[model samples]
Target: MSPGDEHDYRGKDQGGRPDDPYSTLGGTRQTRTRLPDGDAGLPHARRPVRNSRSLVTITGVVVLLIAAIAFANRGGGSDEDAAAPGAEKPGTTGSAPTAATGTKPVQGKNGTIASGFAHDEQGAQSAAANYAVALGSAEMFMKESRHQILDTVYSPAAANKLRAPQDLAYSAEFLARLGLDSDGNAPQGSTFISRTVPVGTKVLAFDDDTAKVAVWYTGLIGMSGQDSTKPVSTTWKTWTAQLSWLGGDWKVTEASEADGPAPVPGDVAASRSDAISKAVEEYGGFTYAR
Candidate 1:
């Protein structure tokens, strides 16, 4: 039970079909989520309706992988063993990738998400990591929170640009398949979890006005309930965000994701759906910073 070992972040994309690398974040399987009638302008996935169930239900088989993401970046262990917190395992490598710099995570909040980052490489990476969390979160599946996510993470122009498409991606039809209501609420007695946790960040490209940051992350997504057909699962992804120093903070201009450089799965047996559901309620998420 490491810091976030039971609460990884699973994913889904706003654009593209289930076959698209970025599209299927819950797992590798393809779900044909058809575009609603008269929405031909949308990039809706079309697969024959099967057994009167939603297609995205068959999308991916998630693996549960909870690893510390934001806490690893807060950096307070300036002790002698500072360089190797991950050495708890027999052959584990030093935690340089998740190494913290004693830098405090941003305290500023933008509607439950961190904001007000510094205008530097560190700030850019922090923003990207936190933004990735917001994008892949359960909130992102809900209309209101999804709007807030875009507005908080992206620039006005970028948010506006992505709004309609994002809404389409999480439409009622899609939610119905995932066993959620039109408002993204899970069925009674069930808990729906969609979260993203960044394991590390990299500055792929940077400039005075803009920066490109890549966040290596894992996500947990699915319904945790006794009768849940879609049990909680995991996905590994690299979310690359293009940020601009706008409004005195790093804002996202664009973002895209790619499938993993995922590690081999460990031998831990999967948790019961009830355990996952309870964990979702008990474990609070974090504000990622670097």
Candidate 2:
């Protein structure tokens, strides 16, 4: 087995739904609690009835009153006041600030992966997050590219230890399950999608020669085609890397993963396989920076 044959960062089955590699990490899964409503298998007691016509009249009046109040509030403020500087904006939800340090995102590239990050805390975080994306990418599924990526991102010692195991994990059986050829290429007319998007990064620890950073990210993986059984889906995870400033660059010394601070799933309808394939082909990824 070669480094290119490795399954993924998570060394688990990559068949239909790839298993969460960070499950063994110390975070526990949270479940929502359901509260029982008013009556529990009890028969309802009958009550005296009021005039149905009167009840309808009262409900209609209440609704109209609420609507009138809402309209009044909408018209309460003056246009100048609404347009004033520093005025609070309506329908604006809070979000984290942009992950920019004003430094160039990358100084150079080692093959297709970004390299030569800044030497400060922000640069270390940026390097770790981008490295996570590369390690989790579809390119890592192939032999030659995987070797290049491992060599680029990981410390020489760490890469040596991981290469053989990774190769074994991405064996022929695993590739078959993911509808890919032994070389990790998808079939003709099929698209294999694997991408990692870092939401944010936290510098857990930092120093002159070493730093630790955790990247909160979301990933998309699977195959897309007319007959694909393993349609692409999204997963949320957090990756922590212990990085060493080696060869004048931050390189991964060790890494681990954990379940995410995931957002609640939304109600967007799933797209058709063909549409998904087309979108994957049309959209290109970015050179992420912090």
Candidate 3:
């Protein structure tokens, strides 16, 4: 699937399709006790003549050993001390770098979608993934919302080039094919669902002003309702975008997509349309970060 591919069921009408309606898814404790000697003749010997000095030395060594072991295991500091200012925390020498950068994900937004990402690799990946979500959302089915998203997510030149074709792709005929009205509304009593869940993102290339990122995602698109013919279904895809630092934000210059690194199907039973509708309504979406 490409960025603007019409194969996306969100914008595909279902009226004429005779094939399968919903297809193409991509402790232990120890104790010791001492016994007294029974000898009476050699009281000193039988009473176990205590070597006080040796006993004290042994006890001191044992205590020091325990303290040393504890300090080494704790990396020489408490958790609070490790977090204190000027403290040198443990290094991630052999460990994998986390997806998180511990920096604020986005500094601003264009409409509802995140924008103003930092001009770094992580920020570019974040921007691309978030842009994928916005472009694949149900909102993109409507003309007004689609325009808003294109303008917000794409660079000015790309937005201008994409507007007409994208508009055509989400036309009345296309919407009807997806069981949506001309205004991108589902029929009364039906819930239209189109959402993108980004599995992860990768930076293919990045520099100060340009970046290429790929977002692997799974998308849900279909209508859910008692009478709905198109049941909610899923598709896996990878959206790759070329982005440029423009207007103090990362914006899409172009985008393409591929099939997926889809996993095997699970054994879970499909939910009823009404249940799907209810879940979609009850659960809100998220603003994804890298």
Candidate 4:
């Protein structure tokens, strides 16, 4: 953690962070932990109780949505240092943006995803942030692209283990529920938007060859079409990745998610679907660096 960045460090199991609703790995986790009351500034910050129907479909899609780049949920461990190196006390009040750094984001790519990080603390953080973006991206909804992401950012064993279950989880029925096709595309004249904006990254722990990093993020999901039932909405989450230096890069071996440290929503009136669609099309993402 850098000087003056303390406000942004969401180190290990903070008191107001999620409890159980966010323990997903491989998109099968149905229970999501929202922020405890102490941090609920927004009217709808806390999620309502999960129903069987919700658990069956929405849960699967959410983790996939994170994978699809609608992105993350990672909780720090109970110990302050366990979740992030140089982390703040669990009871700390709010979050701030990560400070800018001199280091440039890694420019290499494995297919479309970024790759080839330096083997160090910043490298692990960069890996976690980038992987969170990929897993949480909208493309994770599509089969081939999803597979490619799994193989790219995760350890081979972890990717292999997660694939079958995730494929089952993101079923044809699941896509239909979110207004997406089997190919994970939006209907004609509609745009399915799922994007994760990584807010900051903190290294919880690290060594010569392994590290754990946490990524705080805000994401946008839902369809950008006037007729869409699920209109584009935003969410806040923390995703922690247990990573290792494997195959010459940082690869995720395990992951978990938790909700909020979210801010109060602004009073801005919602924009039209066409406007939202155009913005999404015009905006480009960045290569996140720690």
Report the Cα lDDT for candidate 2: 0.77
Q: Identify the candidate with maximal lDDT.
A: 4
lDDT tens readout by residue for model 2, 41-141: 44632222334445445545654665565555553354445343764332122313353444466789888789998787777888998899899999989
TM-score of each: 0.66, 0.66, 0.68, 0.66
| lDDT winner between candidates 3 and 4 | 4
- lDDT (Cα) of model 4: 0.79
Error of 3 at 157 (Å): 0.9
Instruction: Put down candidate 3 lDDT per residue, 1-290, tens digits, no spaces.
Output: 11222332221253333122223321012222343565444544323333344544554565466656655555434445535375433221232333344445788777799877867777787898899999999999988898999999999999999999988888899899889999999999999999999998877777789989899999999999888778899999999999999888899999999998899989999999988988988998877776
lDDT of 4 at 240: 90
User: What overall lDDT goes with each candidate model?
Assistant: 0.77, 0.77, 0.76, 0.79
Alpha carbon deviation, residue 116, candidate 2 (Å): 0.7
Residue 276 displacement (Å), model 4: 0.7
Better of 2 and 3 by TM-score: 3
Give per-residue lDDT, candidate 3, residue 208: 80
| TM-score of model number 3 | 0.68
| Ranking of predictions according to TM-score | 3, 1, 4, 2
